[model samples]
Target: MKSNRVSTRGILVTLCADESRVGMPGRAAPQGKLTGIGVKPIGEVQWQLLYRWLYGVVELLSGEHFMLEMSHLDSLCFEAFLQTFAQTYPHQLHLIQVDTCLST
Candidate 1:
């Protein structure tokens, strides 16, 4: 038995996402004194690799497409994106597909 509730908003947003990274700062150097310097990051991480991600969805009913870009991707970033998407499309359902491994 299911509840007799149907949403008037007829949109199923299916999103596919990919993340790519670039500009890793020329072999990367440590923020602190180097112990024989072999590209080891010690102490606080001062440099970050630039990352670009694209998450997009197309609404079949309305033919509307939206793509989102960000510098990096993490649990925090994912949450923020979800919040923004929800605020923007309060009535639409979202489906996100991740195609990359998030760096730890």
Candidate 2:
């Protein structure tokens, strides 16, 4: 039997997200020995590229269009990443679940 708790808006989407360290400083010269050179990073700003994907984001509802985005991580942490997503699509997100090994 189908439950009566189905969402009236639409089916929930499972978002896939990941972060990678990009624009990081190249390997430093070891023991004061020069090993060629490349573009150096500016200042102490750490950067990580955030990627997210969700199927059928636009086909679900009207006046609620949202798309994928790529930006540097604010604090280089998972929480910050989640916050950014939430802020971007505040009306779309309903629940958040982090992967954890737990017995019910």
- RMSD in Å for all candidates: 9.3, 11.2
lDDT tens digits, residues 1-104, model 1? Answer: 00112134445555555444544454344545666758764565556555576545454555455556766657676667667667767765777676667466
> Model 2, residue 33: what's the lDDT?
29
lDDT of 2 at 53: 26
C-alpha TM-score for every candidate: 0.46, 0.33
Cα lDDT, all candidates:
0.56, 0.39
**Once model 2 is optimally superposed onto the true structure by TM-score, how far is the C-alpha of residue 98 displaced, in angstroms?**
6.2
Per-residue lDDT, model 2, residue 70, is 37
Alpha carbon lDDT of residue 72, candidate 2? Answer: 38
lDDT of 2 by residue, 45-78 (tens): 3344344422112322233333334343333444
lDDT of 2 at 20: 36
Top TM-score hit: 1
